[model samples]
Target: MEFLIAPIIVALLASALALTISILDKHVNNYGDVEININKGKKVLDVKGGDKLLTTLSSEGVFLPSGCGGRGSCGACKCKISTDIGPVLPTEKPYLSIEEINNNTRLACQIKVKKNLDVYIPEELFNAREFSGIVEEINDLTYDIKEVIVSIGDESIDFVSGRYIQLVVPPYGKIKESTQRAYSISSKPSERNKVAMLIRLVPDGIATTWVHKYMKVGDKLRLIGPFGEFEKSDCESVMICIAGGSGMAPFKSIFHDMLEKGEIDREVWYFFGARTTKDLFLLKEFQEMEKKWPNFHFIPALSDCSPDENWDGEQGLITDVLDKYLKSKITPSKHKEGFLCGSPGMIGACINVLNDNGIKDIFYDNFA
Candidate 1:
């Protein structure tokens, strides 16, 4: 009798605890329907509240650029809120400057949409789409650079020449969280259903390391893309473009698109830099393109060429070569535009060179 009574009492206590938890969840965790007004009634989203704005918008098929997958670390998910949700969060403070906070900018991942809110986004973001793709081919273009081709699953992506896509990498080992990294699309825009990237292996880089060591051909991948404002403008200007290493991706797309569109009225000088000959790829293809487009020039330079490798092209640091060319071979006019892609250091150096050469209409994308 004593044992039976004790078991009954324990069961009653367990039931009571479960009931209490359920009641608390229903009251505290539940968020009712919320309304989102975007861009002065350009669109409205009726969603269940309690989730972050980023997740809610994504669920509604409005994909925002987020490098850390809504973790609030990358600071890419910024949106201007017209309606106040709450005070700024600690996670967002680091990324937001005083000007941004003053402008009522908030991290979408950290802001819970618990009520009717107004948010402002760039008009171009409406065109951004998520794509499901399968890795079709992975070829080593150089010793350190791998060319990856992804075939779109159902639909095609319409993007400009110098735009990029964010590849989603799932959590592995110590990462503990999934991440997304942006890579410029290397394939021409004419290849609507296919996208390619020139990936350089970065030692210990979270995404590159995974791609080099674990990722396999034929694996399914997801990406959100066609984001960025890097592209050619309609101006009768001489284009001076500079890149290094994996920076070749966007230029490849730009050049191919130019060739396809027959936009040879503008002169283009593409300067590609590498540490050695082993780091170079696609020279032959660019050479062929040069023949087809007389106004376009492909210049590849090696900074540290080994004795065994026979390299007769430009030699030295890329910036130095660019400075020499800008000062001597090319005369920059006000209409000249500079396009640059590479490491942050290379981009900065190239920018200085361009600015010194009186080329002010410069646009660049740096992968850091």
Candidate 2:
């Protein structure tokens, strides 16, 4: 009789607690209108409070660089805050260095807009705008990679060669809201009316899955762009570019721009890494470009080449091959600029090699 009564009492307590929490949350989260000061009153926005800073700024046509789409995972949407929003969250600490923390850099996605605040973002982001485009074609470059060509229609994009555009992925199935992912533009800057990007399928990647499976030619999609600072420097330094998989996009744009503008005199040694012959692509095209443009050299290295592959090229890890070239093939007299695009591990490894070999001018896209 006591056991039954106790069980009923426990259930009643749990229900009462849940009801209290639901009531508290309603009032606690209800923050009203807030003012956002950008670059110290350069631009001000009136946004509804209680939303994350990233989404709030975005609502006002000011898109900050956000790779993970306000999940507070990517840590890309960083902005310096002059006002005291709060203490640094544990989620943001991993991405922010000690110096950055001291400088008041906060992840915009994590900060709740409880009150008026002042934030500073890069000046270039001011010009960035959302553009709608129709998918012109989806050309298969490899089994896992596809070149997505998009026609911007009446809108034209003015961007540098090595820059990228954020692809706006609409909600599909279980995905509740739209999200954005950045991909480097593979098309040359001369084709401002349209754009092409090399997209490689990533396991469980939301945007990649949508592109490979659900998307079709002529499907209209929205994208925001002309972002990123990775571009060719004005200096006539010899560029040593390295790429793996769909990392080939930006380099393709950069090289074409160079070739078209008769900047071929600025020597380039492009090292492309692949696992087998199957992974190697755009071979004939780049080879022909090399032959026509004397200053351009294409060195496609094949790592883990099987016997049946019948491949004869630079064999070994890409960094190892790079070491050999830096020592013997590539001239030391020319000021070298390293352009690397691949996995973060590969980029870090290559950066070490480049640093060891005295190539300091390194450029890379963060979204990679």
Candidate 3:
């Protein structure tokens, strides 16, 4: 009788708490539709409130530049806010600079669509669109690297020569959600109906392993945009491009564009680095181009050259080779711009070398 009475008392208390929570949620969680004004009301969207601004804008066919979808991690979806949406959250603070914060910049993925909000976005982002294509070809450049050529029908892939595209990888194996990986477009910009991407196999990587093992040549693909601002500058500076692994993608596109437009006489020095002789590719193509275009110089270097290979070219670490070229081969007074693409460690090291050599205007394809 005592045990029965105690059980009854606990059940009654639990029921009362559940009822109170239900009542509170009914009133507290309901937020009606909100209006979003973009670029001073030039574009407006009336979307359901309480969702993140990044998702709401994407639903309205307005694709904002977000690398991690709406996860609030990439910090690529920064937008200027005219009206006070809310105080800046902790998630967005690390990404935003002091100047950006003063300019009222906020991460769209973190800001919830609560009421009428005025946001300013870049005009160029409005031009970026989704592209559906079929993988026409996959050519192996190295044992771990493959080049995927996509045919986009009549849809144009209008982009600057050095910009990158996001590959939308569908869920595979245990990956429950799709993810987007950025790859620099290795194809020529003059060929508007086709896109080429160079991908390297990463160990147990979600996207790379799927591409290497699962993706077929004729499979359909959904990709987005020509993101990043790493294109060649218009200044009359000598171009010094350094790339290793799949980082060779964007520079290939740029050089082709230069050749097609007869702008090959730009005094360019392309340094391609690899661990061994077998890791090197595109030597014959670039060497042929070097013969055709007097201004283009192809410099292929190997860090671990075998004795049997008898490599006569630059044989040292890429940074050491670059340092040698800067001091002895390249003119010291000429204004030079450094183009680097690789992992963060490689890029940072290259930046330091370029800065040390007085090549101040350096650029890299930082595709987040």
- Cα-lDDT of candidate 3: 0.86
Model 2 C-alpha RMSD to native: 5.8
Q: Tell me the TM-score of each prediction against the true structure.
A: 0.86, 0.91, 0.88
* Winner by TM-score between candidate 2 and candidate 1: 2
87: Cα error in model 2, Å: 1.0
Error of 3 at 307 (Å): 2.3
- Per-residue alpha-carbon lDDT of model 2 for 149-186, expressed as tens digits? 99999899998899888899999977788998889999
Q: Encode model 1's per-residue lDDT on 1-368: one tens digit a residue.
A: 99999999999999899679757755698689999998889989999987779989988988777766776777888889989667788889998999999999999988877789999998889999888999999998987789999999668999999998889887876877677888999999989998899989988888888788778899988888878888887887899999998999999999899889989877999999999888889899999998999989899999999878877899999989999998888864436889999988999988998898888899998875
TM-score of 1: 0.86
Which pairs clash inside model 1? none
> What stretches of model 3 exceed 4 Å from their correct place?
1-28
Query: In candidate 3, where is summed lDDT lowest over 10 consecutive residues?
Result: 64-73
Top lDDT model: 2
Clashes of each: 0, 0, 0
Q: Which lDDT value does model 2 have at 318?
A: 95
